[model samples]
Target chain A: MTSRDVLFAAVGLITAAAAVLAVTNRRVLHAGLWLVVSLGGLAGCYLVLGAELVALVQLLVYVGAVVVLVLFALMLTRSGGGEVDTSPAHRWLAAGVGAGMTVLLGGALVAAYGWDTREVAGPGNEHIGEEIFGTWVWPFELLSLLLLAALVTAVAVATTGHSRDRAA
Target chain B: MDLPLAVEIILKAVVVLAAFLTLPLAIGQTEHKVMAHMQGRLGPMEAGPHGIAQLVADGIKFVQKEDVTPASADRWVFKLAPAVALIPYLVALAAIPWSAAWVAADVPASLLLVLAVTSVGVFGTLMAGWGSGNKYSLVGGMRAGAQLVSYELPMVLAAASVAMAAGSLSLTGIAQAWSWWWLIWQLPGALVFLVAAVAELQRVPFDSPLADSEVVFGPYTEYTGLRFAFFLLAEYAGIVVMSLLFTVLFLGGWSGPWSDTLGPLWTLLKAALVAILILWLRIAWPRVREDQLQRLAWLVLLPLALVQLALTGVGVVVWG
Candidate 1:
């Protein structure tokens, strides 16, 4: 394999390993931290693919913002104690869903591209910006509105909780 | 890579690392001496000729002191945290232009990459707090994480405005495209950037995470010797990086009267000016309440930055 292929393989492997660790880790905080590692590895994969803008956005959004949120939730709940859920009743269902998704996605991919090995040119920020604001403008705007609604709802819930506590 | 290109890259990395090591000493000493003078007191006059070698002495002392890990600490994460905190800034220096053609890495998405990588430093603080098994450290880390997250939004928005005007992510491109000094047209955005930058660096007034009086050095309470030194050095390095970024984004980076002849000297001078400005604010301002700090970042700065970004977009379209 070429050096680029090797790099991509390495990153993909790390991402997979970290993803497994994130899901299986006993400590909730450790799980969150592993999620950061997984996301970071995915960002590295993006970098290896030459999508530098996407890689950076992945780092900024996933590693920086989302992971921090996860960690914050863990800390605020005081749930860093290494207790883990040991229930296995849903294991088969989870496996079935996972397998179904894998098959569906793999089939879609194979049908669309027929196992082709062609390289796609890296879509830099300029092209991505055009796509987002031009053709995808409505969906992007709707996504932002959804985020704004979530934020407002969060604030409302917090304020109501505070008022309820004061009244009590 | 070709042999010469490989050699060049290695050489650039060495130069950046050397700067990372020494700049903190110089900037720290400058902060000490300048703050002393501002307060009409002598600062570090004894170490060697106005304490020029004081930081060197401190470095040696840190090296000699016992490296202590807390008894209950998580060993691996605690050990890895400092490198995580410091290495990103070192990598970031590669993308910063010292002069027109003097950048180590001139990638198209470099500025964004630098900001993204540096944000990962928050993980270091969080790791430090969590691994130390100290309640105070955990609280400190959480505060820092929240503060960083709040401040980053405004900073990114302000930078987005500058990127809109420049239409490129390369620092050199931004510097070259500024027909008028960006500080003139983008003053509100620049102010937002500077405030957010200061908070990002966790300097005075915004330093509740490491507030000695309150949280007992915040995330740093358990660290000792070389590890503590790493955190201290990382803070100063952050100041240097933020100053250079401000120079690149707001001030005309490496561009001044006769700057062509002066080369990187003008850039260094502007960076120094911003560094000194940071030190001035650090010494002058009293500590701000944590709530107030968050409110300023989210309530005051974020909207201002967003408005500036919109205005810059309009300006770019009309001017183009």
Candidate 2:
């Protein structure tokens, strides 16, 4: 096998393992930390595949901001230290569902792609920019609007409570 | 004559790593003497000639001290936190163009890589805070995470403005495409970026996260000896990286006279000046209250960043 293939396999394996660990960690804070590792390993996979832009964006948004925010909220709520208590029945159910989903997805992928290695399309900033602005512009802008609405609603919610407290 | 790819890569890594290790000490020395002079006192006269080896002494002292871990702390995370805090700045440094051709790694989107890795550095502080199992550390980490989240917006926007102007995301490309007039045009965004950078670095005036007065050194309260030194090193390294980045983004990087031969020197000189300015800021302003800090970032810097972005778009459309 080629070096690139081996590298990709290694990164993919690490990402998968980290993903599993993230889900299985008993402490919520440690789970969050594992999620960071999982996301970071996924970025490494993207980098191995030469999708530098996507990889960096993933690291930036997911591992950097999202996980940090998750950890922050956990710490703020003082829940970072405690181990999550899960019933044995619920744990078994979660494992079964997770395993089933994995099998289903793996079977579907194997059926579709078979053994062929598809050629990667352009992977850099230029092409990604075109794809987003050119083809996906509408959905992208719509998403922005949705986010803007969410942002405004959040501000209103946050401020209105503070103002009520001040008046009280 | 071309060198082997592996050798070239190794050499570049060595140089970057050297800078990563040494630049922080230099900056730390600058902070010592400059802050001392600024405060009308001798900073480190006893270490070596003019106290130049003060950081060296500090380094030795730190190395010799007992590395203590709090009994209640998470062992693995506590041990790992300092490295996490320190590595991102080193990675970011590899992407910054010391001159048009001097960057260690010319990643296509180096700016994005730099910003991404630096953002990841916040996890280090958060880890230290939580892992320390100290109330002060947790509170400090919370403030740091919140402040970083708040300031990250304007910082990214301001950097995005630079990228939009240059029409390239590469740090080298940005430097090459830079012209004199951008200094005037990008001033507001530059200010926002500078402010955001200070907050990100947990420096003076924007240092509520590490406010020793209230939080007892914040996430670092539980840290001792070498671990504390590592965190301190990370902060100094952060200052150098951010200052160098600011020089590249806003100033005409290596663009003045004799640029061809003196390009890297010009970049380093400008970056040093910026570092001095950052140090000077320590004495210039008091620590901003956390509320005021958030208000400045969200209400002032964010709007200014948005407006600057719009202006940049207009400028590009009009001038292109």
Index of the highest-TM-score prediction: 2
Q: Could you give candidate 2's per-residue lDDT for residues A35-126 as a string of tens digits? A: 89989999998888889999999999998889989999999999988988889999999999999999999899999999778765447689
Q: Candidate 2 lDDT (Cα, whole model)?
A: 0.93
TM-score of 2: 0.97
* Candidate 2 per-residue lDDT over residues B259-302, each given as its tens digit: 99999999999999999999999999999999999999989999
In the predicted model 2, the residue pairs found to clash are none
Write model 1 residue lDDT over B118-197, tens digit each, in one string: 89988888888777878888889888889999999999999889888998887888888876646677999999999999
Q: Please give, for residues A14-70, the per-residue lDDT of candidate 1 as tens digits.
A: 999999898888888888888999999999999999888999999998998999877
Model 2 chain A scores worst on lDDT over the 10 consecutive residues at A115-124
Report model 1's interface C-alpha RMSD after superposition on the true interface residues.
0.7
